[model samples]
Target: MSLLQVSGLTRRFGGLVAVDGVEFNVAEGEIVGLLGPNGSGKTTVLNLLSGALAPDGGSIRFGEHAIHGLAAHRIARLGLARTFQLVRPLGSMDCRDNVIAGLAFGAERRWGSAAQREADDLLARVGLEGRGHAMPGELTYIDQKRLELARALALRPRLLLLDEWLAGLNPTELLEGIKLVQSLRQQGMAILLVEHVMDAIRSLCDRCLVMSAGKRIAIGLPGDVLSDPDVVRAYLGDDHA
Candidate 1:
């Protein structure tokens, strides 16, 4: 069944349409890729789904309830959580504390000592086993990204939105990142990720939704959509296609 259903989703900034009547669905335990070049409104769609930005038109149904204009926290409590393109852990909080915040505020509403224990476990799961005491500023870029994943997972969400969570990494780190995402998929987590790493998308996404100029250009199996002439033109220009 679908965990997220978005129809006629539209968002605008003044006269500029950032996301134009985009529609898609994420099924339970399925990983879907939102693909496009820069400024295709991918992140805007994520923001709207996670309730960071309200859509001017369209409806978002999470599970059975409409959530188009709900507050971000409310959406989190409704089993939807997201990580930003740029990691946004609490600057003043340690790694463990950052995750604790999510557990406390998320769907299950964990708190106190229980939340701390679970936060540390989450940190460990994301390959940050002994780094919970460190501040976000102390982590390397990839470690910080792992922390971001841990924070989102602490929400115990049914559907997770990841915006470029695998953007920058060396070869080895990229491999590890792919493995980490694979582990999440193994655990039956449904994910909608916006990523530019084609290899990662190919390995992780069961389906892809392509966008261009705020419109969905293609939607299908990764191999098919990525090979579509329109998708090729959008990424590499007409010359490469």
Candidate 2:
């Protein structure tokens, strides 16, 4: 059975339909790429799945729970976690403290020295090792992204939603990020990745789900769907395809 099942998911903003009848499944330990051009509603879907935004319609099932319209904290407690397209770390808190917050609040809650230790370990895992005492503003953009990812992992989530997590990285950092995501999947974590870096999508995702204008356009293996005329047209325009 799929770890996550989303069907007929829809969301609206005034007159704009940001996500329209989108549907997909993410199996246990599978990494599915949410691919789309700008304004394709990929992040909107993430918001719906992670409970940052309630859907206007459709159903979301994570394991045994039907989670449509659940609050974000409740969803996190139920073993789903997400990182923002823009990294959000506590400005005043140090990196380790930020991760500790996640540890305290997530599904498998921890506290005291154990949480501290785990927080430090998470920082190390995401390559923020000795920078635990540094504030969010002290880190570079890419490091900030890593810090956010570390916090999400602290949730010990069954499914993770990453919104443009690999966006600002240089080539080398991008490779490391890809490997880190792969390691998580290896350890049995399911991931829904929203990324424009086609290299990472091709290398890390088990399957690709493409969207355009808030609608699902295609879903298939990376190579197959990426090459489809419809998919090509969605990204580069009618002339390119």
Candidate 3:
């Protein structure tokens, strides 16, 4: 069975339909890409899935449970975790403590020294090994992103949702991020990635779902989907048409 199944998922704001009847699935140990241009509803889909926003319609099934309409915290406890397009770390807390909070209260609910050890391991996994004592404001942009990933992993989620996690990285950092994602997949965690970096998408995704104007325009292998005429038109305007 799929780790996550979303069907006819939708959301609206005033007169704008942010996500329209979107549908897709992510299986265990697989990385699925959600590709689209800006305003194409990609992040909205993540929001709905992670319970950051309630859907106006459709179903989200994680395992056997229907997750749409559930409270964010309730949904999180069911083994689903996500990182924001804009990293939001607790600035006042040190890196380790921020992750420790997730370990203590997330799906696993691990606490005390045990949670601290796990948080340390996660920080190391994300390449923030010895920086646990540093404050969020003190770290560089890339380190902050890694901290976000570590916090999400502390949930011990069955499915991980990533939103543009590779947006602002240098070449070396980008390569490191990609490798980290691959390692997570090797460890059997399902990932739904929303990324603008085609190189990362091409490398990490087993299959991709492409969206435009709040609707699916293409779905297939990364190479094929990226080459699709519709996708090209969406990303690069069809002014000649």
Candidate 4:
């Protein structure tokens, strides 16, 4: 059975339909890629699923619970966590404290020394070991992304939504990110990843869903979806395809 189920999901801003009748699912221990060119509504889908935006129609089920219009905090408490395309860390706080806050307020609500220890462990897991004392501004761009991942993990979510988390990484950092994602899957966390990095998609996703103009255009294995003529035309110009 699917860990998450989304059907007929739709959203709009004024007259623009950002996400239109989209559908997909994620199974436990699976990583599903949501791929599309810019303005294809990938991030908007994430926003709707994470409760940052309420859908105008359709349904989203996490396990047996209906999560369509719930507030973001409530959705988060239900073991759904996400990282933004633009990383947002508590700038004034040190890396460790930022993670600690997630532990203290997240799904489990762990607190005190226990939360601190778990935060440290998460930092190490994300390759931010021994950098816990540094402020967010003091970290490199990739390290900040790591910190954001650490914070999301502190929520102990069953399903994670990642939006463009691999966008600006160098080759080495990208490889590390791919390994980290694989490790999460091994640990039984399901993921819905929105990424422009084709290599990352090929390396990490178990299956992929392709979107164009707010609609789902294809769903299949990564290699097959990327090879689809429709996908090529949507990404590259028609002439190039």
Q: Each model's TM-score, in the order given?
A: 0.98, 0.98, 0.97, 0.98
lDDT of 1: 0.94
How do the candidates rank by lDDT, highest first? 2, 4, 1, 3
Candidate 2: regions farther than 4 A off: none
Q: Which tens-of-lDDT digit does each residue in 32-143 have in candidate 4?
A: 9999999999999999999999999999999989999999999999999999999999998999999998898786798888888899999999999998899999999999
Q: Could you tell which candidate, 1 or 3, scores higher by TM-score?
A: 1
Candidate 1: regions farther than 4 A off: none
Candidate 4, which segments miss by more than 4 Å at Cα?
none
lDDT by residue for model 1 over 39-145, one digit each (tens)? Answer: 99999999999999999999999998999999999999999989999999898999999999888888778888899899999999999998889999999999999
Per-model CA lDDT versus the true structure: 0.94, 0.94, 0.92, 0.94
Tens digits of per-residue lDDT, candidate 3, 28-119, equal 89899999989999999999998889999999999999999999898889999999999999999999999998887786688888888888
Single out the weakest 10-residue window by summed lDDT for candidate 2.
43-52
Name the candidate, 3 or 4, with the larger TM-score value. 4
- Model 3 ranges with Cα > 4 A deviation: 239-241
Evaluate model 3: give its TM-score. Answer: 0.97
